[model samples]
Target: MKILVVDDDIHILELVSIHLRQAGYTVVKAMNGLEALKVVDREWPDLAVVDVMMPGMDGYTLTKKLREDTEIPVLLLTAKGEMEDKERGFLAGSDDYLVKPFEPKELLFRIHAILRRYDKAVDRMIQVGPLLINRQSYEVVLGKKSLLLPLKEFELLSVLASRHSQVFTREVLVERVWGFDYEGDEQTLSVHIKRLRDKLEKLTNQVKIVTVRGVGYKLEVSE
Candidate 1:
């Protein structure tokens, strides 16, 4: 897999690149967000390790721009270990966050975890019932008809559909869809669920996602 390591610190960039290369990945190095964008435009990497602080464009802006174009997984590296910083990273579209002074093994583990999650998402798309999510095309289909979905809505549906019939608490949904450090209110999940239900209602009268009342929610496949 090809991976991009973006950091203003040359030493840090080289360190990460060396370890990632050792782990059998093609490593691409970028010193700043502008360079990162240029590199991404030329070559699409499977994953990116972006440092939060940079000279020209910051990592948050880079991550947001990248997310707007593609769903390629991004792991943000931050020097600040504050919870708010982590939350901001997630809000900006980081798939994972790692604090500075992290172990190389931990970085490798996180990369593997993100890749595993992405693979599961791909597998789930094939069996999302009447709903078809084409990641490559960024298109959603309900049966033979196409349905338009906002980015967040698509992400929410992807997570729930992946574990059809399994109960996912509001917290779990927030973490999985919104990211672990998301500071948003629990009502956000409810609002998204309602919107998703409305859209899917057009396809099938029966609700695929069921409310678990006091617990959370679950997706039910109709027979």
Candidate 2:
């Protein structure tokens, strides 16, 4: 999963990024709200970690703006601890609030909590053709049979299934499914794609991951 971190403090931004990366999540950073929005446009993160105080667009306003169009989970991470401050944060569309001087583990806990809530809200599954992916259980069903997948492989399939036949360039898939900071190259992605396809073909050949050579890939449904 990808997380966007927005903080005016460079130290905090790097700190959060490092911790999140170590936890196996891809992290994107922004020094302020405006920059954060631009990153969001590019990364489309599953969640955002935003500081409450910024020069032009404070966390509250930014949260409100995001809520206007998207349900992307927002976690307010700032030194502001007043009851009123948290209330304002919720009113402005924050899903969780965390006070600064916080533990890295605690932050991860909250991140998982917020993401779980978001998943539940959406029913934790995406269906395309005969494939049904259960996000919570991390299982995919092709017709009546279930295929097990590793985390990265499951995420990769989720992206393709969600978009169904839409061709996705390698760069786009890397950013959307693996995060903008994906350290691997086409070889890594190709390996995962092949694994998913190999396992999927064993169960059913009704769905296929089609390669649009010189471009990218798309999921195709067959009779």
Put down candidate 2 lDDT per residue, 111-213, tens digits, no spaces. Answer: 9999988777776788777778898899998667887789999988888887677787888787776767668666988888899889878877788999999
Model 1 residue runs over 4 Å out of place are: 123-223
Q: 22-128, model 1: which lDDT tens digit per residue?
A: 89887888999999988885555779999999977999999999999766799999889999999999999999999999999999999999988887876534356
TM-score of each: 0.56, 0.65
Stretches of candidate 2 above 4 Å error? 124-169, 174-223
Note the clash tally of each candidate.
Answer: 0, 0
Which lDDT values do the candidates have, in the order given? 0.83, 0.86
Q: Please give me the total number of clashing residue pairs in predicted model 1.
A: 0
TM-score of model 2 relative to the true fold? Answer: 0.65
List CA RMSD, all candidates. 16.1, 5.2
